[model samples]
Target chain A: MNKYRIVIEPGSENSNYWKDLWNYRGLFYFLAWRDILVRYKQTVIGILWSVLRPLITIVVFTIVFNKLGNFPSDSGAPYAIMVCAGMLPWQFFSSAFSEAANSLIANSNLLTKVYFPRLIVPASTVIVSIIDFLISFVILIGLFFFYHFIPDWRILFLPLFLLLATLTAMGFGLFIAALNVQYRDFRYVIPFIVQFGLYISPIGFSSTIIYNNANIPDYLKFIYALNPMVGVIDGFRWCILGGSSHLHIPQFIASVGISILFLFIGIWYFRKMEKSFADVI
Target chain B: MRNPIITVENISKSYILKHQNNERYTALRDVITNTAKSIFTKQTIINNSKEEFWALKDISFEINQGDRVGIIGRNGAGKSTLLKVLSRIVAPTKGRITIDGRIASLLEVGTGFHPELSGRENIFLNGSILGMSKKEIKNKFDEIVDFSGVEKFLDTPVKRYSSGMYVRLAFAVAAHLEPEILIVDEVLAVGDAEFQKKCLGKMKDVSSEGRTVLFVSHNMGAISALCSTSIILNKGKIEFNGSVDKAVKIYHNIQTTNKNQVYTSQGINKEIFISETYLKNSENENTLAFSHDEPVYVVIKFYANILLDDLLLSISVSDFEDRKIFSSEVLISKVLSVDKKFGEAILEIPSVFLIPNDYKLNVGIHIPNLQVFDFIENICSFSIVDNGSEFSKYVGTDIGCVFSQSKWAII
Candidate 1:
C-alpha cells in the first residue's frame, strides 16, 4: 500500500525516475532471471554452452595467433592461458553490447503494454551477459590449472577492472540501444561492429606486441588505448601474467576516463530516448 | 466533487505518420543519397512527406474515489490511447493529469508471460510486471494457484498449456494485484464464457472494495451491467459522458453514419459486385428510419462482369450488441435468369416484424448456399420506432421480435 500523488503533464520528466527504478527492482531481477532461464531452457546441453562458447574462442585464438602468426605469450605463461584471460573480457563486452542494443526491440510487447522504468530492459540484458561472464569464469580457472600458471596479487584487482569493462559496455550499449529503436539499420551495423572489434582488441595477441615491436610508433600506442578494450585486455593479462607483465599507467587511466565519459553520455542519451520508446518501438 | 481520485485536464495526443519508404531504416548510403539529392533539388524531402494524426484531442474528465467508469468506444476512437496515457506507458503530447494512490493496469492479459517459463515461475514474473513486489507475490501465491486451477501442471512450461489455461493462469496472477487504482482494458474477451463471467465477477468484487476502476470495453452488455457511468469517444473526441444507458444509446447510433453503404469489391473477384444498397418503406421514401409494422424493401443493385451461376443472396439483421436477432431464409433461393449484366434484387418484408430498436444489416452472396462469393457484415443500419400499433402496446416483457399477430388464452 505505497501511496503517493502522481502528476503527468506533457513533456514532464519524472523527478522520481531514479526512485521508481529502485521500486521496480523486483521486475529487473525477474526479467534477468527469466531471460537467463529461457536462454538455456530448451537446449539439451543447457548451461554447458556458456562454458563451451568461450573455450572454443580460446582454442581458435591460440592456434591462429601463437602458432600461425608467431605471437609471443607473456613470459612463461602458455599462449592459450594468456588468450583465455583476454578473451573473457572481450567476449563479455561484445555480447553485452550486442544484446543490450537489441533489448528494447526484443521486448517490444512489454514496452508497448506496461509502464516501468524503460531503463530496466537494457539494464537487465546487461545482467544476463554478466551471468554468462560468470559462467565462463569457470573455464578460466581450468585453463590456469592446465598451464600451471597461477596469477599473483595483481589478480586481486580483477574485480575493479571487471566493473570498468561492464560500465564501458553498458554505456555504449545504452547509446546504441537508443539509436536502434529509431533506426533498425543498427541491427545490421551491430554484428559488423562486433566482428571488427574482435580483430582490434588484443584478444588473440598481447597488447605488448605494440609496445615491443620496433616497427610500431609510440603515438599510435596512445591511439590504440583509445579502443578501451586495449587497456582492459592489457589489464587482464597483467593480472594473470603476474610479475612478468607490466600494466601501463597512462593507457589504463585514459581507458578509465573515456569509459566514465561514455557512461555519463550514455545515461543522458538513454534518458532522452526512453520517453519515446513506446511510440517508436 | 471535492475529493476526486483522478483528474484529467485537456489531454491531447498526436502522431506523425511518415510516408512509406523502401528502406524504413536510414543507412549511411541512404543518408548520402538523400543529402546529394537535397543539394541538387530545391525542396528537402523530410517534412512534406509526413502527415500529422491526432489520436486524442482535448479530452477532459474526472473520477470520484469509488467510481467504476467505463470508456466505451469503437476501434480508433482513442480508447487505447487514453488507457496508455493513464497507465503512463506513453506520454501525452499536451495537457495534465493528477492521480492519487497506486495505479495498476491490466492492458493485456499475460503482458510478460514467457512461454518457456513454468507456470509457477510465470506467476511470479507476471506479478512483478504488474508492479507487485516479491513479498506481495509470495503472500498471494497460493490464492493465485487455486484460482488458476493449473496445479497439476505448475512445473510444466507454459508453451505446453492450452490457450485457455495460459490466459486463465495469467488472469489469475493479474487479479491478485492490490493497487488502489485499477485500469483494465478488453482482456476478458480472451477467455471462454465461464471464465469471462468469473473475471467480470472478480472485477465487480474489486470495484466494491472502494478502489477507483477505469474499465474499457466494446461489449455494451457488459458495460451496462458493470458500470453506472460511461465515457463515449467518437473520432478522437468525447461525444458523450453520462449515464451508461445514454452512452450506449449514443454508441449504437454512431456506427451507421460513419460506415460505408456502398461497399466495393476492388482487387477482388469481379464476377458479381453489389454496387448500391438502400431501404424504401411502403411510402416509397428512401430512408434509414422507419415505423414499426410498415412494409420495407431492401434493395441491392449489382453488376455482373460474367455470368454467375446459382447465385443466392442472404440478409440478416443484428441488434446493437452484434447478436443476430433475425435473418432471411437459410435455404437456397430460387435461381433468377437475368438478360442484362446490371440488375437489382429486392427482399421485401410485408411488415417490419422487429422490435423498436436499432439494427444492422449483414448481406452476403453465395453459390447455391454452398460457398460464399462476397460477404459484408454490419454494412448499414436503421432504427425502427413505435408508431402507435397494437404490436407495440403489449410491453410487459414480450419484446423479443415483433409479430403482427399472436393468440393469447386465459383459462
Candidate 2:
C-alpha cells in the first residue's frame, strides 16, 4: 500500500506546510483567476480602469506638484515623466497591499470551509495586483513616446526594483491581511495608510531633489531613506529618467534591507496567525 | 493487521463565545485602546467578557479502510466540530490526529462556488478547491458535467441556474472527488431527495472500492442505511460507539430523555414565564414515552413575579410533520385566571385519543384577547406507542395527529 502520513497535534506546526502549499498550487491558480475574471465582469471599462487610474493620478500629481508648487524635476528629467515613474510603483504597492489585506474577509466562505493554505488567498490577491501593475506599466511606455525620450541602459535594472516593490507590498500585505482577520477596523485604516503614504513616499516629487538640497540636514535625508519605497521610486526615476535621479548607494541598500525585513516579518506573522484563521475569521 | 485509515486520539475543540452585547466583529481601534488603557492602569477590565465553550471534549475514534462510519448527534453536539478537526478546517485545541491517506471533505456543497462563474468554470474551480489537481479535474471533466446533468448550460453562470440545478452541479463536483478517504457533513441535505439518493449510492460505491468514509447527519435512517458502524455524540462527548443500529437507538434515547423537560425563559414579558414543562403518565409520574390507553398529563409549572389577572393558559398540539392539529384554551368562553401565582398546573388528558406518533406542545399565557404574555412554541415533544387497543392494534394506523374514539355500528 502506498501510504502518506499526516499527523495533527495541538500548537505544533505542520512540517509539510510548505510542501502542501506547493502541492495546492492548482488552487492558487484558480482562486487568482477567479478574482481577476470576476473583478470587472459587469463593468464597461473593465481592464481599462487599471491604466485610467495611474494616468489620472500622474496628471494630477504633475500639475499640482510641478506646475502649482513649482518643484523642479531632476536636472535632466521631465516633470510629468518623473511623477509617472514614481506613480507606477506606488499604485502597485497600494493596490496590492489593500487587495491582499481584504482577501481573507472577501473569501471568508472559502477560508472557513476548505483546508488549503490560507496564504494562497492573499498571495493570489497579490498576483492580481501584479497583473494590474503590468497593465498600468503600459501607460508609462505611452508617456515615453509622447516625450520622445528613450530611457538609457539603466532601464535594464528596472526589474530588480520592481521585484523589490512587489516584495515590499506583499510583505506588508501579508501582515495587514493577517491582522485584518482579527481586527476588522483595518479596513478603515488601509485607506488612511495609503493616502498618508502618498505624500511621504516621494511619489509626486523626486528623491534626488531631497538629496541635492543643501539646506536639509544629512541625518533627515538618511531617515527618509527608511521608507522602503524610497529606493523603489528612486530606482524607477533612475531608469526611466536616465541619469537625472541618481540612486544613492547607502540609502538604496538601507531600503533594500528594510524591504527584506518587512518580507520576513510579514511571512512570520501570517503563518503564526494562519492556523487560527478558520476559527476566528 | 492493516493500519487504520484514520485515528483521532483525544481531540478536543474549545470556542470562545463572545457575548451578544460585545462587538463580535472585533475592530483594531478597540483592541488598541483597550491595550493602552490596561497598560496605564496595570489592569484589564473587559466591558463584556466572553465565555469559553468546549464544542468537542476528548473525542477518540479509529476507522479502518472501507469502514463507512456515521456520526450521530443533536445540534451543537460537536459532530460538525469533529468533522472540521478531521478535515483540518479547525485545529483541535488538544490531543492529536493521524491519517494515512488523502482525505477530501465537503463540509458544505458549493463551498467555494462563485455564483458569478459559469458552470463549466465552477466545475474545475470547485474540483481544485476540493484538492483535485488541474490535470485530474481535466480528466474527470466530462464525467462531472454528465453526472450533474447540466451540460446544456455549462457556459451559463450558476446564479441564473435554479437552486436545484446549482445544488446538483455542486454535489456532482463534490461526489466526483476521488480521495482515499471522504468526509461529508450534513451538506447532503441541500440536494433534492432524488439527488440525495444518488449521492448515497455514490458514497456506497466509493466505500465498496475499499475507501473509508465518515458521514455526519441527523437523519437516523440515512445513518443506519449507509454506515456499518456509528458513534453517538452528546454534549461534545461520544456517548456510544458500536453498531449503527445500537448507536442510533442510543442517540434517540438520549434525545427523548434530554428533551423531556423543556423550559423557556425567552418571552415577550418576564412577568409570567414557563419555568418548567414536562410529561407524565396517568399515575402522575414523569415519562417521555406513553402508552395508547394510558392518560398523559402535561405538567406545567409557572412563576409570576408581579400580580397579574386574566391570565390564560392554552396549548396547541402538532403532529410530527409540524402540522397543527388543534388548539384549545382551558375554557373558550370563560377567561382563565391564575389561581396560584407561582405553582404547578396539571392539564390532564383523560385518555390520549391520539394515534401512535410524536406530538409537539406549544404553551402560552395570555390576558384573553388583549395580548399574549408568554408563548413557547414547540417547547416539548412526546411519543405515544400502541398498547394493543382495538384502534391501536391496527398497525400502521399512526395516520393522524389526534386519536378520536367513536362507536361504529354495522348500520
By DockQ thresholds, what CAPRI class is model 1?
acceptable
* A19-95 per-residue lDDT for model 2 (tens digits): 99999999999999998989888799999999999999899999999899999887567788888999999999999
Candidate 1 on B1-411: residue-level lDDT in tens?
Answer: 358888899999998887735554446556567778778896686667668999999999998888889998899999999999999999999999999889999999999899989999999999999999999999999999999899999999999999999999999998999988999999877777677777877888998998888999866656766787899988889999998765765676575466553444442555666667777766676656565657768887666665655676678889777878767833223333355766667778666577766777888777764776667787657766544344332332345765546678899
Candidate 1 chain A, which ten residues in sequence have the lowest lDDT sum?
A: A1-10
TM-score of each: 0.80, 0.79
The docking quality of candidate 1, as DockQ, is 0.41
Q: Tell me the chain A TM-score of model 2.
A: 0.96
lDDT at residue A270 of model 1 (Cα atoms) = 92
Error of 1 at B79 (Å): 0.7
**Model 1 interface RMSD over true interface Cα atoms:** 2.6
| Residue B139, candidate 1: C-alpha displacement in angstroms | 1.3
- Expressed as tens digits, the lDDT of each residue in A1-281 for candidate 1 is 12678989877789999999998999999999999889988789999998999999899889998999998888668899899989999999999999988999899999999999988998998888888999999988998788776788999999887888888898888988998888788888889989998988889888777877788888888788888888788888887778778887888888778888888998899999888889977
What lDDT tens digits, residue by residue, belong to model 2 across residues B204-248?
788888888899976555666678899889899998999875575
- Per candidate, the number of residue pairs that clash is 0, 2
Report per-candidate DockQ. Answer: 0.41, 0.47
